[model samples]
Target: MKAALVGADGALLYEVRRATGRERGPDAVVEGILGFAAELRAYGAEHFGESALAAGVAVPGIVDAENGIAVYAANLGWRDVPMRALLAERLGGVPVALGHDVRTGGLAEGRLGAGRGADRFMFIPLGTGIAGAIGIGGTIEAGAHGYAGEIGHVVVRPDGPECGCRQRGCLETLASAAAVSRAWAAASGDPEADAADCAKAVESGDPEAVRVWLDAVDALAAGLVTALTLLDPRTLIIGGGLAEAGETLFTPLRAAVEERVTFQKLPEIVPAALGDTAGCLGAGLLAWDLVAPADGPAAVTGSGAP
Candidate 1:
């Protein structure tokens, strides 16, 4: 888990990182987050002469953001956890906002990063798992059930591979960082090889590495093109580990997207400028929004559902 003590101006005055300690069990992890949040609130009160006006938390998984319910996080083994109420009780009545991790990051990108000027944008992170956040104005459209931007589950290749969502041929199965790592490691006969290693091999003109890399790129392009057709976003912000390959990933991915475009207006695909700080900044925005609504698209809140 990561957090920050952000001022009203959205600047982080102090920051912290902690392990979720999933090995200690899901309940323990949840409790740990609650305690850490409460501590941060107290710290701000002690040092700044005031407590935090509001707090925002972003988490991974299928979240029911509006009600502050962490619906289910497969990796953390969480289901129906009442994060907002728990944290609020601990923080002594401070208002709290809950959000999806990816959407929160997108909020930051749209408001302050690569998508700053685009009213409609999409932030897609090709990380361990693929996920997306659609930014309209400065807020992410969380959908009626807080399940919008689930493009990773879009079936781009019906016969491709099975996803953890128990669906066949989902986009993430073929294009995510984990998928690339798995494929490259298998193809290169190195059990420990990761996506970064694949990129290095591709740079060195390894045929197998090039083939594997191209396959993932092509799959990603398909998913992106489909998204463009549906949303017609003015900007598409790509982030996460695979993007670290820089031109190696962008040049070909751009070309592939060009090849597939027929009638859609091509969005300016750019790498996320905020790096790892996007989510933290977004959480701060949401917290500020809670204290002052009617303010410019304050960070996407648990109330941002749909």
Candidate 2:
């Protein structure tokens, strides 16, 4: 678990990281989050000389933001957890904002990072699993039931490998960081090989590595094309572990997207600027929203939330 207290200017005032001790179950994880928040609060009071008016938290899984509940999180083994209320109580009645991690990252990207100024954008993270955040007009659209941008589950190869979600050929099965590594390992007959090794081999012109890389890229492109056609977003911001490939990923992805588009305006594809800090920054934004009264459309930059 990780926690950070961010100032209204988006500066990290205090931070903490600790193991979730999650083997004990959901209660432990919830306790860890609350404990971390308490530590952050103490640090802020001592060092920053201020108390936060509100708190924002981002958690993995299906978060019902409107209801302030974490509906489900397979990794955390939590279901219907009232995270916002818990945090509010721990913090002594401060307002709290809760959101999904991916959506929060997307919110940061849309407001202040790569997708800034884009009316419509998609933030796709190609890490252990494929997931996305759709932003329209500076606000992320969480969809009905708060599960809108689960692009990873979109089947790209209908007859391909089975996925943890009990489906076959989901995009995550082929194009995610873990999937790419697994595919490369299988192809090379080396159980220890990972995606980074595979990328290195591809860079050295290894035929098998190139093949695996191309296949993963193709699957990703297929999924992205669907998103582009459906949303007509003005930009697509790629982040997470796989995007570490930089131009090697973007060059091919741009070409593939261009090939798939017939007459639509192709969106500019770019790397995320905030790196891993996006979620925390976005959480801060949410907290700012809770405390700072909104006069109109929230302006970008150091102007707080409103």
The candidate that wins on TM-score is: 1
The candidate maximizing lDDT is 1
Clashing pairs in 1: 285-299, 286-299
Q: Which regions of candidate 2 deviate over 4 angstroms?
A: 293-306
Report RMSD (Å) for each prediction in the order shown: 3.6, 2.2
What is the Cα-based lDDT of residue 211 in candidate 2?
A: 90
Model 2 lDDT on a 0 to 1 scale: 0.86
State the weakest 10-residue window (summed lDDT) of model 2. 295-304
Model 1, total clashes:
2
* lDDT agreement with native, every candidate: 0.88, 0.86
Tell me the tens digit of each residue's lDDT in model 1 across 54-115.
88999999888789989999999999999999988888888899999999999888887899
| C-alpha positional error of residue 68 in candidate 2 after TM-score superposition, expressed in Å | 0.9
